[model samples]
Target: MTPILLIEQVLNGLQSGIMLFLMAAGLTLIFGVMGLINLAHGSLYMIGAFAAAAVAGWTGSFTLALAAALAAAALAGCIIEMVVIRRLYDRDHLDQVLATFALILIFSEGTRWLFGSFPLYLDVPAALSGPVRLPGGILYPSYRLLIIVIGLLIAIGLFQLIARTRIGIQIRAGESDREMIGALGVDISRLYTIVFALGAALAGLAGALVGAIQSVQVGMGEPVLILAFVVIVIGGIGSIKGALVGALLVGLTDTLGGVLLPLFFGLFMDPSSATTIGSALASMSIYILMALVLLFRPTGLYGRA
Candidate 1:
Protein backbone atom coordinates (compact mmCIF):
# COMPACT_ATOMS: atom_id res chain seq x y z
CA MET A 1 0.00 0.00 0.00
CA THR A 2 2.73 2.40 0.95
CA PRO A 3 5.75 3.31 -1.18
CA ILE A 4 8.11 1.65 1.29
CA LEU A 5 6.13 -1.58 1.06
CA LEU A 6 6.23 -1.31 -2.72
CA ILE A 7 10.01 -0.92 -2.63
CA GLU A 8 10.34 -3.98 -0.44
CA GLN A 9 8.22 -5.98 -2.86
CA VAL A 10 10.39 -4.78 -5.73
CA LEU A 11 13.49 -5.96 -3.91
CA ASN A 12 11.89 -9.31 -3.30
CA GLY A 13 11.01 -9.50 -6.97
CA LEU A 14 14.61 -8.71 -7.86
CA GLN A 15 15.89 -11.48 -5.63
CA SER A 16 13.49 -13.95 -7.16
CA GLY A 17 14.49 -12.84 -10.64
CA ILE A 18 18.15 -13.24 -9.75
CA MET A 19 17.59 -16.85 -8.73
CA LEU A 20 15.66 -17.49 -11.91
CA PHE A 21 18.55 -15.99 -13.85
CA LEU A 22 20.91 -18.42 -12.17
CA MET A 23 18.70 -21.30 -13.23
CA ALA A 24 17.98 -19.98 -16.73
CA ALA A 25 21.53 -18.94 -17.48
CA GLY A 26 22.76 -22.51 -17.23
CA LEU A 27 19.80 -23.83 -19.21
CA THR A 28 20.31 -21.41 -22.07
CA LEU A 29 24.03 -22.10 -22.04
CA ILE A 30 23.52 -25.84 -22.28
CA PHE A 31 20.96 -25.64 -25.05
CA GLY A 32 22.89 -22.99 -26.94
CA VAL A 33 26.19 -24.79 -26.85
CA MET A 34 25.15 -28.44 -26.86
CA GLY A 35 21.85 -28.41 -28.70
CA LEU A 36 20.44 -30.68 -26.02
CA ILE A 37 17.16 -30.31 -24.16
CA ASN A 38 17.90 -31.47 -20.64
CA LEU A 39 14.68 -32.01 -18.74
CA ALA A 40 16.80 -33.26 -15.83
CA HIS A 41 18.52 -29.95 -15.22
CA GLY A 42 16.06 -29.55 -12.38
CA SER A 43 17.47 -32.73 -10.89
CA LEU A 44 20.86 -31.07 -10.66
CA TYR A 45 19.24 -28.17 -8.82
CA MET A 46 17.64 -30.59 -6.35
CA ILE A 47 20.94 -32.38 -5.87
CA GLY A 48 22.60 -29.11 -5.01
CA ALA A 49 19.97 -28.22 -2.42
CA PHE A 50 20.16 -31.64 -0.81
CA ALA A 51 23.93 -31.54 -0.79
CA ALA A 52 23.97 -28.13 0.82
CA ALA A 53 21.35 -29.10 3.37
CA ALA A 54 23.17 -32.31 4.32
CA VAL A 55 26.53 -30.62 4.64
CA ALA A 56 25.13 -27.68 6.57
CA GLY A 57 23.45 -30.08 8.94
CA TRP A 58 26.68 -31.93 9.60
CA THR A 59 29.32 -29.22 9.57
CA GLY A 60 27.29 -26.19 10.68
CA SER A 61 29.15 -24.13 8.11
CA PHE A 62 27.21 -22.44 5.33
CA THR A 63 30.35 -21.92 3.26
CA LEU A 64 31.21 -25.58 3.28
CA ALA A 65 27.65 -26.45 2.40
CA LEU A 66 27.78 -24.21 -0.65
CA ALA A 67 31.07 -25.76 -1.77
CA ALA A 68 29.56 -29.18 -1.36
CA ALA A 69 26.58 -28.13 -3.46
CA LEU A 70 28.78 -26.91 -6.30
CA ALA A 71 30.97 -30.01 -6.18
CA ALA A 72 28.13 -32.49 -5.95
CA ALA A 73 26.06 -30.94 -8.71
CA ALA A 74 29.05 -30.48 -11.00
CA LEU A 75 30.16 -34.05 -10.42
CA ALA A 76 26.65 -35.35 -11.06
CA GLY A 77 26.43 -33.28 -14.23
CA CYS A 78 29.79 -34.60 -15.48
CA ILE A 79 28.72 -38.17 -14.91
CA ILE A 80 25.35 -37.70 -16.54
CA GLU A 81 26.97 -36.08 -19.55
CA MET A 82 29.52 -38.84 -19.93
CA VAL A 83 27.41 -41.89 -19.24
CA VAL A 84 24.09 -40.86 -20.79
CA ILE A 85 23.94 -37.46 -22.48
CA ARG A 86 27.00 -38.09 -24.61
CA ARG A 87 25.24 -40.69 -26.71
CA LEU A 88 22.17 -38.55 -27.24
CA TYR A 89 23.94 -35.56 -28.74
CA ASP A 90 23.57 -36.73 -32.32
CA ARG A 91 20.06 -38.04 -31.83
CA ASP A 92 16.87 -36.13 -32.49
CA HIS A 93 15.23 -33.76 -30.00
CA LEU A 94 12.60 -36.36 -29.09
CA ASP A 95 15.28 -38.81 -28.00
CA GLN A 96 17.06 -36.19 -25.93
CA VAL A 97 13.81 -35.17 -24.28
CA LEU A 98 12.87 -38.75 -23.47
CA ALA A 99 16.30 -39.59 -22.07
CA THR A 100 16.49 -36.47 -19.94
CA PHE A 101 12.95 -37.00 -18.75
CA ALA A 102 13.97 -40.48 -17.57
CA LEU A 103 16.96 -38.96 -15.81
CA ILE A 104 14.58 -36.68 -13.89
CA LEU A 105 12.65 -39.68 -12.55
CA ILE A 106 15.85 -41.50 -11.68
CA PHE A 107 17.26 -38.51 -9.86
CA SER A 108 14.03 -37.87 -7.95
CA GLU A 109 13.70 -41.48 -6.76
CA GLY A 110 17.40 -41.71 -5.94
CA THR A 111 17.26 -38.50 -3.91
CA ARG A 112 14.12 -39.63 -2.09
CA TRP A 113 15.88 -42.89 -1.25
CA LEU A 114 18.88 -41.06 0.14
CA PHE A 115 17.24 -38.12 1.87
CA GLY A 116 13.85 -39.65 2.60
CA SER A 117 10.56 -37.84 2.05
CA PHE A 118 11.07 -35.27 4.76
CA PRO A 119 12.17 -31.76 3.89
CA LEU A 120 15.46 -30.51 5.27
CA TYR A 121 15.86 -27.04 6.69
CA LEU A 122 18.94 -24.95 5.92
CA ASP A 123 19.34 -22.18 8.44
CA VAL A 124 20.70 -18.85 7.37
CA PRO A 125 24.19 -18.31 8.67
CA ALA A 126 24.41 -16.31 11.91
CA ALA A 127 26.21 -13.58 10.02
CA LEU A 128 23.30 -13.10 7.66
CA SER A 129 20.31 -14.12 9.75
CA GLY A 130 18.93 -10.64 10.44
CA PRO A 131 17.58 -7.70 8.50
CA VAL A 132 19.75 -4.82 7.44
CA ARG A 133 18.65 -1.23 7.15
CA LEU A 134 18.72 0.23 3.68
CA PRO A 135 18.24 3.74 2.35
CA GLY A 136 14.99 5.45 3.37
CA GLY A 137 14.88 3.42 6.62
CA ILE A 138 13.72 0.26 4.88
CA LEU A 139 14.96 -3.01 6.35
CA TYR A 140 15.43 -6.19 4.33
CA PRO A 141 16.70 -9.68 5.06
CA SER A 142 20.47 -9.72 4.80
CA TYR A 143 20.51 -13.25 3.40
CA ARG A 144 18.28 -12.24 0.50
CA LEU A 145 20.42 -9.19 -0.14
CA LEU A 146 23.43 -11.45 -0.23
CA ILE A 147 21.68 -13.71 -2.66
CA ILE A 148 20.98 -10.78 -4.96
CA VAL A 149 24.58 -9.59 -4.75
CA ILE A 150 25.95 -13.05 -5.36
CA GLY A 151 23.62 -13.63 -8.27
CA LEU A 152 24.60 -10.35 -9.91
CA LEU A 153 28.27 -11.10 -9.37
CA ILE A 154 27.86 -14.47 -11.00
CA ALA A 155 26.05 -12.85 -13.90
CA ILE A 156 28.92 -10.45 -14.46
CA GLY A 157 31.47 -13.22 -14.20
CA LEU A 158 29.56 -15.32 -16.73
CA PHE A 159 29.45 -12.43 -19.15
CA GLN A 160 33.19 -11.88 -18.84
CA LEU A 161 33.94 -15.54 -19.21
CA ILE A 162 31.90 -15.82 -22.39
CA ALA A 163 33.25 -12.59 -23.88
CA ARG A 164 36.92 -12.81 -22.87
CA THR A 165 37.99 -16.37 -22.09
CA ARG A 166 39.54 -18.91 -24.46
CA ILE A 167 36.97 -21.51 -23.54
CA GLY A 168 34.35 -18.96 -24.42
CA ILE A 169 35.55 -18.76 -27.99
CA GLN A 170 35.38 -22.50 -28.26
CA ILE A 171 31.88 -22.44 -26.78
CA ARG A 172 30.73 -19.84 -29.26
CA ALA A 173 32.30 -21.89 -32.02
CA GLY A 174 30.60 -25.02 -30.78
CA GLU A 175 27.32 -23.19 -30.73
CA SER A 176 27.80 -22.14 -34.31
CA ASP A 177 29.17 -25.44 -35.59
CA ARG A 178 30.35 -28.39 -33.52
CA GLU A 179 32.13 -29.96 -36.48
CA MET A 180 34.28 -26.89 -37.07
CA ILE A 181 35.24 -26.71 -33.41
CA GLY A 182 36.26 -30.36 -33.54
CA ALA A 183 38.19 -29.77 -36.75
CA LEU A 184 40.08 -27.02 -34.95
CA GLY A 185 41.24 -29.63 -32.41
CA VAL A 186 39.21 -28.08 -29.63
CA ASP A 187 37.90 -31.41 -28.35
CA ILE A 188 34.16 -30.86 -28.74
CA SER A 189 33.22 -33.63 -26.34
CA ARG A 190 35.31 -32.17 -23.56
CA LEU A 191 33.82 -28.76 -24.22
CA TYR A 192 30.33 -30.17 -23.99
CA THR A 193 31.07 -31.84 -20.69
CA ILE A 194 32.61 -28.70 -19.29
CA VAL A 195 29.69 -26.56 -20.41
CA PHE A 196 27.12 -28.96 -19.01
CA ALA A 197 28.97 -29.17 -15.71
CA LEU A 198 29.20 -25.42 -15.51
CA GLY A 199 25.50 -25.08 -16.18
CA ALA A 200 24.70 -27.67 -13.52
CA ALA A 201 26.94 -25.93 -11.06
CA LEU A 202 25.06 -22.66 -11.56
CA ALA A 203 21.74 -24.41 -11.06
CA GLY A 204 23.04 -26.05 -7.92
CA LEU A 205 24.26 -22.73 -6.61
CA ALA A 206 20.80 -21.28 -7.11
CA GLY A 207 19.23 -24.23 -5.33
CA ALA A 208 21.59 -23.97 -2.39
CA LEU A 209 21.02 -20.26 -2.03
CA VAL A 210 17.24 -20.48 -2.28
CA GLY A 211 17.17 -23.49 0.04
CA ALA A 212 17.88 -21.25 3.00
CA ILE A 213 14.76 -19.20 2.36
CA GLN A 214 12.60 -22.20 1.44
CA SER A 215 12.53 -25.82 2.52
CA VAL A 216 15.08 -28.06 0.85
CA GLN A 217 12.93 -31.01 -0.14
CA VAL A 218 12.93 -33.86 -2.61
CA GLY A 219 11.66 -32.93 -6.09
CA MET A 220 11.96 -29.25 -5.17
CA GLY A 221 13.40 -28.28 -8.52
CA GLU A 222 10.49 -29.19 -10.80
CA PRO A 223 8.41 -26.08 -10.18
CA VAL A 224 11.40 -23.82 -10.58
CA LEU A 225 12.38 -25.77 -13.66
CA ILE A 226 9.05 -24.95 -15.26
CA LEU A 227 9.60 -21.28 -14.56
CA ALA A 228 13.15 -21.48 -15.85
CA PHE A 229 11.84 -22.97 -19.09
CA VAL A 230 9.38 -20.14 -19.36
CA VAL A 231 12.28 -17.77 -18.73
CA ILE A 232 14.33 -19.22 -21.56
CA VAL A 233 11.37 -19.19 -23.88
CA ILE A 234 10.69 -15.55 -23.07
CA GLY A 235 14.35 -14.58 -23.18
CA GLY A 236 15.24 -16.71 -26.19
CA ILE A 237 17.04 -20.00 -26.02
CA GLY A 238 20.82 -19.62 -25.59
CA SER A 239 20.78 -15.88 -24.91
CA ILE A 240 22.16 -14.86 -21.53
CA LYS A 241 21.17 -11.19 -21.76
CA GLY A 242 17.68 -12.21 -22.70
CA ALA A 243 17.55 -14.51 -19.71
CA LEU A 244 18.49 -11.71 -17.34
CA VAL A 245 15.98 -9.27 -18.74
CA GLY A 246 13.23 -11.83 -19.05
CA ALA A 247 13.81 -13.15 -15.57
CA LEU A 248 13.60 -9.68 -14.06
CA LEU A 249 10.47 -8.95 -16.02
CA VAL A 250 8.89 -12.25 -14.97
CA GLY A 251 9.91 -11.81 -11.38
CA LEU A 252 8.66 -8.26 -11.12
CA THR A 253 5.44 -9.04 -12.92
CA ASP A 254 4.73 -12.07 -10.77
CA THR A 255 5.51 -10.46 -7.44
CA LEU A 256 3.98 -7.08 -8.15
CA GLY A 257 0.91 -8.52 -9.76
CA GLY A 258 0.13 -10.64 -6.76
CA VAL A 259 0.54 -7.70 -4.42
CA LEU A 260 -1.00 -5.00 -6.54
CA LEU A 261 -3.84 -6.74 -8.31
CA PRO A 262 -5.76 -7.47 -5.11
CA LEU A 263 -5.47 -3.87 -4.07
CA PHE A 264 -6.52 -2.67 -7.50
CA PHE A 265 -9.59 -4.88 -7.51
CA GLY A 266 -10.38 -4.12 -3.88
CA LEU A 267 -11.05 -0.55 -4.91
CA PHE A 268 -14.35 -1.60 -6.48
CA MET A 269 -15.14 -5.01 -4.94
CA ASP A 270 -15.24 -6.97 -1.71
CA PRO A 271 -11.83 -7.82 -0.21
CA SER A 272 -12.37 -11.59 -0.37
CA SER A 273 -13.51 -11.58 -3.96
CA ALA A 274 -10.72 -9.26 -4.99
CA THR A 275 -8.16 -11.44 -3.28
CA THR A 276 -9.46 -14.54 -5.04
CA ILE A 277 -9.52 -12.98 -8.50
CA GLY A 278 -6.19 -11.23 -7.99
CA SER A 279 -4.39 -14.37 -6.87
CA ALA A 280 -5.64 -16.24 -9.89
CA LEU A 281 -4.51 -13.54 -12.30
CA ALA A 282 -1.21 -13.10 -10.52
CA SER A 283 -0.46 -16.77 -10.86
CA MET A 284 -0.89 -16.50 -14.62
CA SER A 285 0.82 -13.12 -15.07
CA ILE A 286 4.22 -14.44 -16.05
CA TYR A 287 2.78 -16.77 -18.67
CA ILE A 288 0.69 -13.90 -20.01
CA LEU A 289 3.80 -11.75 -20.20
CA MET A 290 5.65 -14.55 -21.96
CA ALA A 291 2.94 -14.91 -24.54
CA LEU A 292 2.89 -11.17 -25.22
CA VAL A 293 6.65 -11.08 -25.66
CA LEU A 294 6.58 -14.06 -27.97
CA LEU A 295 3.85 -12.49 -29.95
CA PHE A 296 5.95 -9.45 -30.64
CA ARG A 297 9.43 -10.94 -30.80
CA PRO A 298 9.47 -14.66 -31.38
CA THR A 299 13.20 -14.80 -30.75
CA GLY A 300 12.75 -12.82 -27.51
CA LEU A 301 14.42 -9.64 -26.42
CA TYR A 302 18.16 -9.58 -27.27
CA GLY A 303 17.76 -12.81 -29.26
CA ARG A 304 19.21 -13.01 -32.74
CA ALA A 305 16.95 -13.41 -35.74
Candidate 2:
Protein backbone atom coordinates (compact mmCIF):
# COMPACT_ATOMS: atom_id res chain seq x y z
CA MET A 1 0.00 0.00 0.00
CA THR A 2 1.07 3.56 -0.62
CA PRO A 3 2.14 5.85 2.21
CA ILE A 4 -1.08 7.85 1.93
CA LEU A 5 -3.17 4.71 2.18
CA LEU A 6 -1.17 3.63 5.21
CA ILE A 7 -1.74 6.96 6.89
CA GLU A 8 -5.48 6.80 6.21
CA GLN A 9 -5.68 3.31 7.62
CA VAL A 10 -3.84 4.41 10.75
CA LEU A 11 -6.29 7.24 11.19
CA ASN A 12 -9.15 4.82 10.72
CA GLY A 13 -7.63 2.57 13.38
CA LEU A 14 -7.22 5.47 15.79
CA GLN A 15 -10.85 6.43 15.30
CA SER A 16 -12.03 2.91 15.98
CA GLY A 17 -9.75 2.60 19.00
CA ILE A 18 -11.05 5.77 20.59
CA MET A 19 -14.64 4.71 20.15
CA LEU A 20 -13.86 1.35 21.73
CA PHE A 21 -12.29 3.24 24.60
CA LEU A 22 -15.58 4.99 25.21
CA MET A 23 -17.37 1.68 25.59
CA ALA A 24 -14.63 -0.07 27.55
CA ALA A 25 -14.09 2.78 29.95
CA GLY A 26 -17.63 2.56 31.22
CA LEU A 27 -17.60 -1.22 31.36
CA THR A 28 -14.41 -1.21 33.39
CA LEU A 29 -15.63 1.47 35.71
CA ILE A 30 -18.84 -0.37 36.47
CA PHE A 31 -17.03 -3.62 37.00
CA GLY A 32 -14.41 -2.01 39.22
CA VAL A 33 -16.75 -0.02 41.37
CA MET A 34 -19.81 -2.23 41.53
CA GLY A 35 -18.31 -5.67 41.04
CA LEU A 36 -21.09 -6.26 38.59
CA ILE A 37 -20.65 -8.13 35.32
CA ASN A 38 -23.07 -6.39 33.00
CA LEU A 39 -23.81 -8.16 29.79
CA ALA A 40 -26.56 -5.62 29.11
CA HIS A 41 -24.27 -2.61 28.88
CA GLY A 42 -24.46 -2.97 25.10
CA SER A 43 -28.23 -2.59 25.34
CA LEU A 44 -27.71 0.85 26.82
CA TYR A 45 -25.52 1.60 23.81
CA MET A 46 -28.30 0.53 21.44
CA ILE A 47 -30.72 2.68 23.41
CA GLY A 48 -28.44 5.66 22.86
CA ALA A 49 -28.25 5.12 19.11
CA PHE A 50 -31.98 4.62 18.74
CA ALA A 51 -32.73 7.63 20.89
CA ALA A 52 -30.35 9.76 18.86
CA ALA A 53 -31.83 8.58 15.57
CA ALA A 54 -35.37 9.18 16.70
CA VAL A 55 -34.58 12.62 18.06
CA ALA A 56 -32.53 13.59 15.03
CA GLY A 57 -35.38 12.53 12.77
CA TRP A 58 -37.67 14.85 14.67
CA THR A 59 -35.39 17.85 15.22
CA GLY A 60 -32.78 17.56 12.44
CA SER A 61 -30.10 18.68 14.85
CA PHE A 62 -27.11 16.53 15.79
CA THR A 63 -26.61 18.32 19.07
CA LEU A 64 -30.17 17.72 20.13
CA ALA A 65 -29.92 14.11 19.06
CA LEU A 66 -26.83 13.61 21.20
CA ALA A 67 -28.51 15.22 24.16
CA ALA A 68 -31.47 12.93 23.77
CA ALA A 69 -29.14 9.98 23.49
CA LEU A 70 -27.30 10.83 26.69
CA ALA A 71 -30.47 11.54 28.59
CA ALA A 72 -32.24 8.41 27.40
CA ALA A 73 -29.35 6.10 28.10
CA ALA A 74 -28.61 7.61 31.49
CA LEU A 75 -32.23 7.44 32.45
CA ALA A 76 -32.49 3.88 31.29
CA GLY A 77 -29.38 3.00 33.24
CA CYS A 78 -30.66 4.66 36.38
CA ILE A 79 -33.97 2.87 36.14
CA ILE A 80 -32.35 -0.47 35.48
CA GLU A 81 -29.94 -0.01 38.33
CA MET A 82 -32.74 0.92 40.67
CA VAL A 83 -35.11 -1.80 39.52
CA VAL A 84 -32.94 -4.77 38.53
CA ILE A 85 -29.21 -4.25 38.89
CA ARG A 86 -29.35 -3.18 42.49
CA ARG A 87 -30.92 -6.46 43.42
CA LEU A 88 -28.18 -8.38 41.64
CA TYR A 89 -25.28 -6.55 43.24
CA ASP A 90 -24.56 -9.40 45.62
CA ARG A 91 -25.52 -12.17 43.21
CA ASP A 92 -23.09 -14.47 41.49
CA HIS A 93 -21.54 -13.60 38.13
CA LEU A 94 -23.61 -16.28 36.42
CA ASP A 95 -26.77 -14.67 37.71
CA GLN A 96 -25.71 -11.24 36.55
CA VAL A 97 -24.79 -12.63 33.13
CA LEU A 98 -28.11 -14.42 32.73
CA ALA A 99 -30.08 -11.42 33.90
CA THR A 100 -28.28 -9.03 31.59
CA PHE A 101 -28.59 -11.40 28.65
CA ALA A 102 -32.33 -11.40 29.15
CA LEU A 103 -32.16 -7.63 29.15
CA ILE A 104 -30.48 -7.74 25.75
CA LEU A 105 -33.48 -9.61 24.36
CA ILE A 106 -35.87 -7.23 26.06
CA PHE A 107 -34.04 -4.20 24.69
CA SER A 108 -33.79 -5.60 21.17
CA GLU A 109 -37.48 -6.46 20.92
CA GLY A 110 -38.54 -3.27 22.64
CA THR A 111 -36.48 -1.24 20.19
CA ARG A 112 -37.89 -3.11 17.21
CA TRP A 113 -41.40 -2.60 18.52
CA LEU A 114 -40.83 1.12 18.85
CA PHE A 115 -38.79 1.85 15.74
CA GLY A 116 -39.70 -1.03 13.47
CA SER A 117 -37.10 -3.37 11.99
CA PHE A 118 -35.80 -0.96 9.40
CA PRO A 119 -32.47 0.60 10.21
CA LEU A 120 -32.47 4.34 10.79
CA TYR A 121 -29.89 6.54 9.16
CA LEU A 122 -28.07 9.45 10.79
CA ASP A 123 -26.53 12.15 8.66
CA VAL A 124 -23.16 13.59 9.51
CA PRO A 125 -23.53 17.21 10.40
CA ALA A 126 -23.00 19.55 7.43
CA ALA A 127 -19.90 20.91 9.09
CA LEU A 128 -18.39 17.43 9.39
CA SER A 129 -19.60 15.74 6.22
CA GLY A 130 -16.56 16.02 4.02
CA PRO A 131 -12.88 15.12 3.99
CA VAL A 132 -10.13 17.48 5.03
CA ARG A 133 -6.57 17.82 3.78
CA LEU A 134 -3.98 16.95 6.36
CA PRO A 135 -0.25 17.43 6.56
CA GLY A 136 1.80 15.41 4.01
CA GLY A 137 -1.12 15.48 1.54
CA ILE A 138 -3.23 13.06 3.56
CA LEU A 139 -6.99 13.47 3.51
CA TYR A 140 -9.42 12.14 6.13
CA PRO A 141 -13.11 12.27 6.89
CA SER A 142 -13.90 15.25 9.08
CA TYR A 143 -16.50 13.32 11.09
CA ARG A 144 -14.05 10.54 11.88
CA LEU A 145 -11.40 13.09 12.83
CA LEU A 146 -13.99 14.68 15.06
CA ILE A 147 -14.59 11.32 16.73
CA ILE A 148 -10.91 11.02 17.59
CA VAL A 149 -10.81 14.50 19.08
CA ILE A 150 -14.00 13.96 21.05
CA GLY A 151 -12.85 10.58 22.31
CA LEU A 152 -9.56 12.03 23.50
CA LEU A 153 -11.34 14.88 25.20
CA ILE A 154 -13.64 12.46 26.95
CA ALA A 155 -10.67 10.42 28.07
CA ILE A 156 -9.03 13.48 29.55
CA GLY A 157 -12.27 14.55 31.15
CA LEU A 158 -12.77 11.12 32.69
CA PHE A 159 -9.25 11.10 34.06
CA GLN A 160 -9.77 14.50 35.62
CA LEU A 161 -13.14 13.51 37.02
CA ILE A 162 -11.72 10.40 38.63
CA ALA A 163 -8.46 11.88 39.87
CA ARG A 164 -9.35 15.47 40.75
CA THR A 165 -12.90 15.47 42.05
CA ARG A 166 -14.76 14.51 45.23
CA ILE A 167 -16.93 12.05 43.36
CA GLY A 168 -13.81 10.47 42.00
CA ILE A 169 -12.49 10.11 45.51
CA GLN A 170 -15.63 8.30 46.55
CA ILE A 171 -15.42 6.07 43.51
CA ARG A 172 -11.85 5.15 44.26
CA ALA A 173 -12.68 4.55 47.88
CA GLY A 174 -15.70 2.44 47.01
CA GLU A 175 -13.64 0.37 44.65
CA SER A 176 -11.26 -0.32 47.47
CA ASP A 177 -13.90 -1.05 50.10
CA ARG A 178 -17.61 -0.67 49.59
CA GLU A 179 -18.50 -1.60 53.16
CA MET A 180 -16.07 0.92 54.54
CA ILE A 181 -17.50 3.69 52.38
CA GLY A 182 -21.02 2.75 53.35
CA ALA A 183 -20.07 2.65 57.05
CA LEU A 184 -18.51 6.08 56.68
CA GLY A 185 -21.94 7.52 55.78
CA VAL A 186 -21.43 7.67 52.04
CA ASP A 187 -24.75 6.67 50.50
CA ILE A 188 -23.39 3.70 48.60
CA SER A 189 -26.62 3.02 46.81
CA ARG A 190 -26.83 6.53 45.47
CA LEU A 191 -23.22 6.41 44.43
CA TYR A 192 -23.87 3.20 42.53
CA THR A 193 -26.73 4.82 40.66
CA ILE A 194 -24.61 7.81 39.74
CA VAL A 195 -21.74 5.66 38.48
CA PHE A 196 -24.04 3.46 36.47
CA ALA A 197 -25.71 6.49 34.96
CA LEU A 198 -22.37 7.99 34.13
CA GLY A 199 -21.29 4.81 32.37
CA ALA A 200 -24.54 4.61 30.44
CA ALA A 201 -24.14 8.21 29.33
CA LEU A 202 -20.70 7.46 27.95
CA ALA A 203 -22.02 4.46 26.04
CA GLY A 204 -24.85 6.58 24.72
CA LEU A 205 -22.50 9.25 23.51
CA ALA A 206 -20.40 6.65 21.71
CA GLY A 207 -23.44 5.17 20.03
CA ALA A 208 -24.68 8.56 18.89
CA LEU A 209 -21.33 9.55 17.46
CA VAL A 210 -20.91 6.24 15.67
CA GLY A 211 -24.49 6.09 14.39
CA ALA A 212 -23.67 8.86 11.94
CA ILE A 213 -21.19 6.56 10.25
CA GLN A 214 -22.93 3.22 10.63
CA SER A 215 -26.55 2.17 10.30
CA VAL A 216 -28.55 2.66 13.50
CA GLN A 217 -30.66 -0.38 14.22
CA VAL A 218 -31.50 -3.11 16.67
CA GLY A 219 -28.55 -5.21 17.90
CA MET A 220 -26.04 -2.66 16.55
CA GLY A 221 -24.25 -2.51 19.87
CA GLU A 222 -23.46 -6.21 20.34
CA PRO A 223 -20.46 -6.31 18.01
CA VAL A 224 -18.97 -3.21 19.54
CA LEU A 225 -19.71 -4.60 22.99
CA ILE A 226 -17.75 -7.76 22.26
CA LEU A 227 -14.82 -5.69 21.09
CA ALA A 228 -15.10 -3.54 24.19
CA PHE A 229 -14.80 -6.64 26.32
CA VAL A 230 -11.70 -7.63 24.48
CA VAL A 231 -10.32 -4.14 24.98
CA ILE A 232 -10.90 -4.16 28.74
CA VAL A 233 -9.52 -7.65 29.08
CA ILE A 234 -6.41 -6.83 27.12
CA GLY A 235 -5.95 -3.55 28.97
CA GLY A 236 -6.74 -5.08 32.38
CA ILE A 237 -10.22 -5.10 33.84
CA GLY A 238 -11.14 -1.94 35.77
CA SER A 239 -8.22 0.10 34.53
CA ILE A 240 -9.14 3.06 32.34
CA LYS A 241 -5.55 3.54 31.27
CA GLY A 242 -5.45 -0.10 30.28
CA ALA A 243 -8.69 0.30 28.34
CA LEU A 244 -7.25 3.14 26.26
CA VAL A 245 -3.98 1.34 25.62
CA GLY A 246 -5.70 -1.93 24.78
CA ALA A 247 -8.19 -0.25 22.44
CA LEU A 248 -5.48 1.44 20.42
CA LEU A 249 -3.51 -1.77 20.19
CA VAL A 250 -6.49 -3.82 19.06
CA GLY A 251 -7.67 -1.18 16.59
CA LEU A 252 -4.29 -0.80 14.94
CA THR A 253 -3.69 -4.54 14.93
CA ASP A 254 -7.04 -5.26 13.32
CA THR A 255 -6.87 -2.43 10.77
CA LEU A 256 -3.25 -2.89 9.70
CA GLY A 257 -3.42 -6.68 9.78
CA GLY A 258 -6.25 -6.64 7.27
CA VAL A 259 -4.29 -4.37 4.95
CA LEU A 260 -0.74 -5.56 5.39
CA LEU A 261 -1.15 -9.30 5.84
CA PRO A 262 -2.73 -9.70 2.40
CA LEU A 263 0.12 -7.84 0.80
CA PHE A 264 2.68 -9.99 2.56
CA PHE A 265 0.90 -13.22 1.63
CA GLY A 266 0.57 -12.12 -2.00
CA LEU A 267 4.34 -12.06 -2.30
CA PHE A 268 4.39 -15.83 -1.72
CA MET A 269 1.00 -17.06 -2.97
CA ASP A 270 -1.72 -16.46 -5.54
CA PRO A 271 -3.80 -13.35 -4.99
CA SER A 272 -7.09 -15.09 -4.20
CA SER A 273 -5.58 -17.63 -1.81
CA ALA A 274 -3.43 -14.99 -0.23
CA THR A 275 -6.39 -12.70 0.32
CA THR A 276 -8.47 -15.42 1.94
CA ILE A 277 -5.71 -16.63 4.22
CA GLY A 278 -4.70 -13.12 5.12
CA SER A 279 -8.22 -12.11 5.92
CA ALA A 280 -8.71 -15.12 8.15
CA LEU A 281 -5.47 -14.38 9.97
CA ALA A 282 -6.36 -10.76 10.27
CA SER A 283 -9.61 -11.68 11.98
CA MET A 284 -7.66 -13.70 14.53
CA SER A 285 -4.90 -11.19 15.12
CA ILE A 286 -6.48 -9.55 18.12
CA TYR A 287 -7.28 -12.86 19.73
CA ILE A 288 -3.73 -13.97 19.20
CA LEU A 289 -2.48 -10.79 20.78
CA MET A 290 -4.85 -11.34 23.69
CA ALA A 291 -3.59 -14.88 24.14
CA LEU A 292 -0.01 -13.74 24.12
CA VAL A 293 -0.73 -11.06 26.63
CA LEU A 294 -2.53 -13.51 28.84
CA LEU A 295 0.25 -16.01 28.60
CA PHE A 296 2.57 -13.57 30.27
CA ARG A 297 0.13 -11.39 32.20
CA PRO A 298 -3.06 -13.29 32.92
CA THR A 299 -4.85 -10.42 34.59
CA GLY A 300 -4.11 -8.11 31.61
CA LEU A 301 -1.42 -5.51 31.04
CA TYR A 302 -2.49 -3.32 33.94
CA GLY A 303 -4.76 -5.57 35.94
CA ARG A 304 -4.12 -5.93 39.65
CA ALA A 305 -3.30 -9.23 41.29
lDDT of 1 at 225: 95
- Give the CA lDDT, 0 to 100, for residue 19 in model 2: 93
TM-scores, one per candidate: 0.98, 0.98
Whole-model Cα lDDT of every candidate shown, in order: 0.93, 0.94
Residue 192 in candidate 2, Cα distance off native in Å: 0.6
Q: lDDT tens string, model 2, 1-305?
A: 79999999999999999999999999999999999988888999999999999999899999999999999999999999999999999999999999999999999999999999999988889999999999999888999999999999999999999999999999999888989999999999999999999999999999999998998989999999999999999999888899999999999998999999999999999999999999999999999999999999999999997
For residues 1-305, write the lDDT of model 1, one tens digit per residue.
88999999999999999999999999999999998999999999999999999999999999999999999999999999999999998999999999999999999999999888999989889999999999998999999999999999999999999999999888888878888889989988899999999999999999999998898998899999999999999998888888998889888998999999999999999999999999999999999999999999998877777
Candidate 2 lands at a TM-score of: 0.98
